[model samples]
Target: MGTTTNIIRVLFISILIDFLEFTIILPLLPKILTYYGRDTGINQDSLYVQTMSFVQFIQNLTGAPNDAKWNSVLFGGIIGSLFSFLQFFSSTLCGAASDRYGRKPMLLLSMIGISVSYGIWCVSFNLTIFMLARVIGGLSKANVAIILAIVSDSTTENERNRAMAWIGAAFSLGFIFGPLLGAFCSQWGIAYWPNSTMMFFIVPAVISLVLSLINIVFIIQCCPETLPIAKRDSKQTTITDISNKILPWHLFKFTAIHNVKSVDDIIILRRLGLASFLYMIIFAGLEFTITFLVYNRFNWNSMKQGKMFFIMGLCMALVQGGYVRRIPPGKEIIAAISSNIISHTNQDL
Candidate 1:
């Protein structure tokens, strides 16, 4: 029992770190890009330059004040999208690899990959190196799914939802603290090391790197293999398996076809997946847009943006921690679906 408790504790910290790494960039991205843009010798034809020009044109048409700062937000969005694209492919492969080998190996590898990327960020001097870090870091995005699987393995069905709630709470807390820490580190670096370029972004990245390394060491010392040999998936690696790992669409087919026990289950799962996909499409656009909107309207810096995110994280934490557990699973699903439908309808109006 103590072992199980330790595993869950470590996994929770791992999840928190995963989210912290991702959200830390939210407040720092514009500043990072603005620093990148000051290079007068950058090629005009480069993708980054072209993207900035295009965004500037859009700003002109919208009657918004033309500031080089908009370039940073747009460039950041493109890099973030690139990360998401890489994550789409890597998630399937990592999940499958875990099933074949064991959870501990995959978790350790994923954490190491994340740490290495952050280390790269700490030393990166150009856009190419920074984007490379984003790509490598995003490719290890399967840790959250693995953490969920681990929770499933460790808990009884009755306790699974409660464990998941705590994980979600940790996620909110991570976001709450991540932006604050990033803002603080950036300001601290600027105050003490004004000559160092990218210190604002690099310091936060270094902090993330240190936490990841600590988490990796903790897992190596303590986390045991939860999936026994008898329960482990076959280790066979066929051509189809390889293809499934590379193609994101194949993940949908793999999960739906292999896991669905009934026609009703298939319908329900597909509907939920469709809803989630549509919601994300809209959410991504809104999330990206709001950053630019707030920046243009309020002339806010990274610290102010971090405060905004803190409010969002605080609300999410309160709702998940205080309210989610009181509801039954069946009712929760119904409420979620109903709320989404109403949200869509209101947007249309």
Candidate 2:
């Protein structure tokens, strides 16, 4: 029991750090895009320039407002989408690999990749390099899923729900603090070295890098292998298997779940999966673009954006911790429907 408690604690901290590093760039995206877009010395024929040109062309073709603010929003959306796209595949691959190997090894490998990504960001002077950093970060973002797996491996069925709720709390806390920390670092850099453009971004990247490195060290020294050898899945996951897992058709059909024996259960799972997919689509679109919208409309600097995220995170934490977990099991659907209706109605108003 003591070991299980310690393992859960480590998993919680690991996830918190992962989200903290991930969200640090949220409030800074608009400014980051602006900085990269205005670099006059970058070669016009380079990949970065070409990509930016294509984005600008799309914006112009779509008849979007011709201004730096809106353009930054569009560019930020593209970057955000690109990250999600890579993560979509990499997460499946990581989960499969973890099943074959142990969870600890795969978790370490993902953390290493994430740490290297932040290291690259620290030196990213151009949009191309910055995009590369995002690519690496997205591909390495297997921490959350793996941490949940670890919790499942370590906890009993009765304790699992509570443990997962704590994981949700970690996420909320990360979002609450990470953006504020990033904004503070940016402000500090600007105050001390107002002329240094590199320092403005590098400060946040450096902090993220340091946190990831610390996480890596903590895992190496403290985290134990949660999956026992007898329970391990020894099958080699092939390219075809991976392709099947990630492909939209197979995913929508719930083909990866081999244990469900009943047709009705499979149908229910598919419907639930589809609902989640649609919800995430709407949620992600708003999430990625909200910073840009606020910046454009209110001229919000990093600190103001950070405060907004803090409030959003705080509200989410309060709701999840205080109300969401206490709902009776069968009433989840009703609660979800009610929340969505209220959310959309509020948005309309």
Candidate 3:
């Protein structure tokens, strides 16, 4: 039990650091896009310029707004979508690999990948390199899911919920603090090194890299192999099996589950999957674009953006910690419906 408790604590810290690195860039996305867009030193034939031209061409073709602010938003959106797309595929691969290998090895690999990504970001001089950093970060972001798996492996069924709640709290705290820290670092960098664009971004990247390196060391020294050899899935997962998992199927017709024979069960599963999928789409869309929206609409800088996210994260943590957990078990569907209705109504307003 003491070992289990220690493992959970380490995993919690790992997740908190990962999310801090993840959300640190949220308030800076718009600024990042704008910086690359307006920088005149970039060669016209370079990847950054070519990519921006392609994005602008697509915007023109699609009749997207043709202004600097809108262009920044569009570029940020494209980058954000690419990151998410890569994550979607990499997450499935990582999960399968963990099942085959031990959890610690896969987790270490993920952390190393993330650390390398941040290292690249620290030296990213142009948009192309920055995009590459994002790609690597996305591909390495299986830590959260793997952390949950570790929690499951280390905890008894009766203790799982409490452990999961602690993980959730780590996420909430990360969201609450990460952006503010990033904002402070960014502002400090800009103030101290006013003439250096690289310093503005490098400061936050360096901090993230340090945290990742600490996580990697901690895992190597302390984390144990949760999946014992006797309990391991020895069946070699083939390419086709991995492909099936990675491919995105229609939400209304989920084809992943092989054992459910009842039509009613299938229908219920599909409905639930569709609901979750749509909810994520909407939530993620807003979350990504909110930075750009505020930047464009209110002319807010990083500090203001950080404060906005702080408030948002605080509210989310409060609701989840205070209200959501207390809802009666059978009333989950009703609660979900009510929350969705309220969320959508707020959006409309």
Which scores greater on lDDT, model 1 or model 2?
Answer: 2
- Which runs of model 2 end up more than 4 angstroms from their true locations? 41-45, 60-63
For all candidates in order, the CA lDDT equals 0.75, 0.85, 0.81
Q: TM-scores for all candidates?
A: 0.87, 0.94, 0.90
Query: Model 1 off-target regions past 4 Å?
Result: 1-5, 42-47, 50-72, 242-249, 253-259, 286-289, 338-349
Span of ten consecutive residues with least summed lDDT in model 3: 36-45
Following a full C-alpha superposition, what root-mean-square deviation does model 1 have from the true structure?
3.6
Model 2 Cα displacement at 286 (Å)? 2.2
Which structure is stronger by lDDT: 1 or 3?
Answer: 3
Please name the candidate that would achieve the greatest TM-score relative to the true structure. 2
Model 3 residue pairs with clashes: none
Best by lDDT: 2
lDDT of 1 by residue, 116-228 (tens): 88899988777767777888888977777777778878987677777787788888888888887788888888888999876788788888888888878878887778888
Residue 123 lDDT in candidate 2: 92
- Error in Å for residue 242 of model 2: 1.6
